[model samples]
Target: MQPYSHARLRHSWLPLRPCPRLLPKESSNTSDAFDTLIESFAFPEKFDFVDIDLGRIRRAARAPQARQLTLHLAIRDAPAESPAAQALSDLDAASFKLFCTPVVNLFQRDATSIQLTSTDRAYPVTPEPLETGTPLDVYSIDAVRLGDRTQSEHEKGASSSTAAPRTAVLPYRALSHGRQPDPTVAYWTAFRDPYAAAGNARAPILLSLIGLDGGSAQVRHPQIDVDVTATNGDLPSRLPIGAPDSDLVHEGAALACPIRLLTQPTLPCSHARGHGALWRVVAGLSLHPFDLTQTGLKAFKDFLRLHAPRTNIVAQRSIDAIVGLDHQPAMKWMSLDGQFPSFVRGIEIVVSLEESALRDVTLHLFARTLDRFFAPYAPTNSYVQLIIRSSQAGQELHRCPARSGTRPVI
Candidate 1:
């Protein structure tokens, strides 16, 4: 994983959209504490960027009792070894985007700072905000680069301009802060099937609770019969659900299909609202179910049926043998930097074998490759027709005119 960082912007980063957050009940003590925390910590300069949406600020008002707030900002397709490396990665030069979300009350505070029990790391929290400061902690970061096939066109008349960034001030209310019995037990048990295991299963799927209440927490690994739960000392009754992980996949035949992994976090008591981001991941295995094999077979069948309908050897033993041995093309995800969304990364296709294995190498391969190639100048309303021929005496190759709706031959 390579560390990547966003370039420091001189302005804020929030777009002019309606922020969706609820405000907390106001109290003099809570306001004083929050204001003091904001001022003392100087959070804006400390964080690479901040979101100051009014709704987020209002939501934080509910966390008056919260001593500290833990933030996890997720940047897609950007992975780094450390914060310093992440800061040096040329995120500005790459085609990518930075999406930041807030996580509330993930730490316990001693007297002067916030602490994490699991990692045994403490972060300093002051009563005043710093004008220019360093980040106290670096949470987890994961990124995926999208690909673009049309490089020549992509380079033609390219523009390197961008809009200014923005920041938002979110008031993350103290949600539930206790531990509960691992409710993921049932989910984990379902992952234990031998058939599912044979399918390259994703085990121990997690479903965590997240919301405005400080609630009990739990961990259940049903596949192995393990359960662990914990709770906060002071406000045990009013806590919310646990934090959730990404969805568990039953890898196998599903890998050959176009599928998306969606993570739905634990909901609030209201059943309508919650405090978590739904992370979407593109899932595929390299050389497992052979999605490309399936695609190639389909395309070969099309060529045989549509282009060569009179051929009687389509189902012969040799055809089957070739199909059995043929390898699928390779596909990869890439980034041109800030171009397409997560769903639209650049796609690359590679051809390895010679077209001679089938019929005519040059003509067929050219036609297929051209049809598959990504280009800005792709014909909008035209089609390509290919033909192959073999000659023993001719020393030169030449294209011969063919009648309308007929394949061309040399």
Candidate 2:
């Protein structure tokens, strides 16, 4: 129902660039070469600002007059501050030098209210006693989180493991609009899995930093604190919240995309700009490896089909079976001759007539032929191939094979 601004900083400080080779003949793959060039030009994490010079590009235009250009800017966390904290801050444009670590488990002990206390004497501190050992100096909010019920057939089938609960993180950031930034973070909120979907899904957590951004730094405000009281009603549905490393083997795999570096021109407002950049980094890394593996599997399947026909049929059946198609007729055709391959699992036969004869005589002979000539060797995987040369001709030469595997005696 509501659009959420992401709090995380995506790695977009990298942008795509063109390859040096002008012709396809000069490079292995132009697209890949271009991707490399993009990576080469990727910006370091430290620079988050970009300036637009419209005057420089408008040389041909009569209005070469200089105009102030509006640029969309992204700011990285200050070196003294951690990116994780920037994600959690409430100020629109506050700068912190401390590194913020991501908190995976936000559900600790529930607090009835939160108190903000300054770590430094220069900053105002709330007098409220925090949960024991809750970091001193930082505004501490004691809040309560509760879970509600889930109803569904799937929930009914869920086992105890499915109902298991875990801690969720609530991420927040501060932004400045027009007034002085609030010194204390506020409006803390988080999302959790409803009891039914508890173990199976991830939970979203969102917290609002009350009024930390606006205006100039000269307008100092008192340190604000929140007293989060618990409620008996249902936990709310909406809260927004927001990788591991693999040692690469030979540059590993990469997804083709443009990347841009982010810079934090202003401290408190960095998240408002940096979130999109952080998302790009994460998306590229996640899909690259999966794409590589899928390509390999498809090529292997194609190779099998080119080398062996028998194996190809068997493998095709196996693949079809995986998609839930079974009991279809097998594709093996055989003539009256006994020649057949070992791979075939079944056979069929068709009988035909040769020359003209009396109707009753033909009927009787056909029955006798099947009983006396062919029925005896039914256990063997062999069958008669009856060929009818001409219907109007008189009785033609009749031939039958013997049980010793010799040519049919005429």
Candidate 3:
């Protein structure tokens, strides 16, 4: 056995900031006010860099009666020579159109009372080709304004003496190139009512940018040998890779390779509204290396009947008549009520491969059963211990622990 090779590539979220010229001058009062405003918006740290426009804050601080102000935002860290920067430059040269929309959250005001609107303007902006990046001068925010309730009542044919606070529209601006904008970038308008006294207003806005394609990115690594053993002393064999999306490779033994495992970050669609928006973006990776032949399937059924005798008769009949193994590989054993049966508690898995091959094997033992006997338990620590042994001499080769929510290569 020899030492293994490893490589890692990481992509960071683009930093967000106010337009350079509009940044407020250095002052404690202005900076404090600006920081408070930036915190209220609650932009996702992984997607956009959120901060307050100091120039707007300074102007507001100096003139308390000023009714309106606009804060412009742009990407802060894209180098001119980067791949994403080049992609944006190409998009700009081609005059591609980008669309903008507003996502708002009101904390203290009624939803119907305040009207938050954004211009339907489309701008010519695009994300970097291989990574995530937003260009400068892409989005703007408008200041909050207060309207007279009495003027509203007169228009509605009602008489009222009190002049209560009426409709308030948050300020936001959109910049466009001459050509029509693409529907990629969607802006969200977030602001606290400037009319309200300082420290009393709070609002959070979320901005989502789409249209970045990750299908071009594919990861290829050395192949690793895998064997599936069942309780009846029967081993599942590898089938020919016929499916278009199959990741199995054959080199004397069945090898599993992850080709489309890594992907670029993508924002969820607009329908996933409200506080839970971030959780909707999920990435999953799974690989099934071997399949059960007709003989192996019968052996698995017999093993199931002998072990789980109390299993429902209907479930047993369904298992006996199971088909489709010829075309699709089986990944899980039997799952009853979304849980592995008690009989599948202490199954052992032996990996007998060289260190070079071990580097490519990411054993993801999920909560479901595997190979009709092995069901990795989901303990409190969220880790499953895996022991690798040498097949020739039956000696301990390695000890690896698989952790949940992360990829651990064995």
Candidate 4:
């Protein structure tokens, strides 16, 4: 309703110059070469990371030789403190240094993994071309990370057993926007069942920092609001808030995004911004992950489709605006074969498309299919209703247990 200058910073996957390289012809062990290159880089002494996000590698099997090294660098943007003021401060732009220790969590054990931190920051970043020759040899040392899991009791339990406490770190791959929550959920999904056996189904207890991107550094701000003048509710507040090894907050607040919050549960997703009517439509499907009803069915199918993107009947361009998913998974269950996803418990859409399952699918197969005809990547999209029976607005939905018990799913 209102267009406010939401606080935001200029973030970019800096493409450094003089990229370091080792010709395959020059070395037999590219792994060793990778180690040597990532162990440390002569980054510009002036520009250091306010924060950094290790992103996924854009690996093109077609062109394996030249892999794009993508990394996120946070600019020093503080409220009231203009770029000119930051230049005058002690840690000014002219002579910046990155503190690599606590900002990232890289859980990899290979050539691709390099020891990084405030004191032992590594990665040979250069502006100019450092290596010559294609068919080059490059070794990925480890998985890159961006969020800090040290605070997450569950994530801590999962990581602490094998490695030392890790800070948030993104992988050395190029990413335009930060990692969304779905990927983060998928990230946690990789852990052994016991880790999440206790409290994994609920929203993850992660210290999501990047979610607070735009807004004053002194005080946190919300991304979207029904009316800021009347209710200054921030959508990002739904994310867990705390100060554990962070430069922002009480000084440099978090920089969060609205889109990233959609992946989490409706509690934070809706309460954070105080937009229940709005998010209920977007996040209603999230309620289905562990259940099997209404929007949940669509969510199940969406998760399945996420695993195999090719089989999705809904056009990629139209998914976010997907109309309410059919309460019943198409009983025919044509494409899925017999297998179902394991992350969620219950009937695998729990209504598994058996003849009985068709009972559910038949309800909205045609309408769900018709939803695809509407608008696109732009805003002002159509709304998909939830299958839940709650006729009242701004109310929470409840359902029965999604599955019988925890059984090993292949």
lDDT of 3 by residue, 206-300 (tens): 22222223111111211111111101001111223234674333334566643221112122111223354323211001122122344444444
Segments of candidate 3 deviating more than 4 angstroms: 1-125, 128-344, 355-385, 401-410
> Looking at model 1, which ten-residue stretch has the lowest summed lDDT?
277-286
Per-residue lDDT for 1-410 in model 4, tens only?
22223233333322121222221122342322122222211111111223333222222122345444423335443223332334445543445334422111111121212222333212321111113311111122223343332333334356557554433333222242355522222110011122432342322111111223321122122110010001111222345543345323332337642221112221111112233533443443332232334555565445433322232222232233323333332212221223453332112111222221121122122122222211121122112122222222212222221212222233
* Candidate 2 residue lDDT tens string, 25-71: 32343234223322221211222222334343343233444353232
lDDT of 1 by residue, 336-384 (tens): 2333422321212222222223331223222232222122111222122
RMSD values for the candidates in order, in angstroms, are 29.7, 34.0, 29.3, 26.2
TM-score versus the correct structure, for each prediction: 0.14, 0.14, 0.16, 0.17
Q: What is the Cα-based TM-score of model 1?
A: 0.14
Best by lDDT: 3
- Point to the candidate with the largest TM-score: 4
Model 4 residue runs over 4 Å out of place are 1-140, 143-290, 310-404, 407-410
Better of 1 and 2 by lDDT: 2
lDDT per model vs. reference: 0.25, 0.27, 0.28, 0.26
How many clashing residue pairs, candidate 3?
10
Candidate 4 residue-wise lDDT at 167: 34
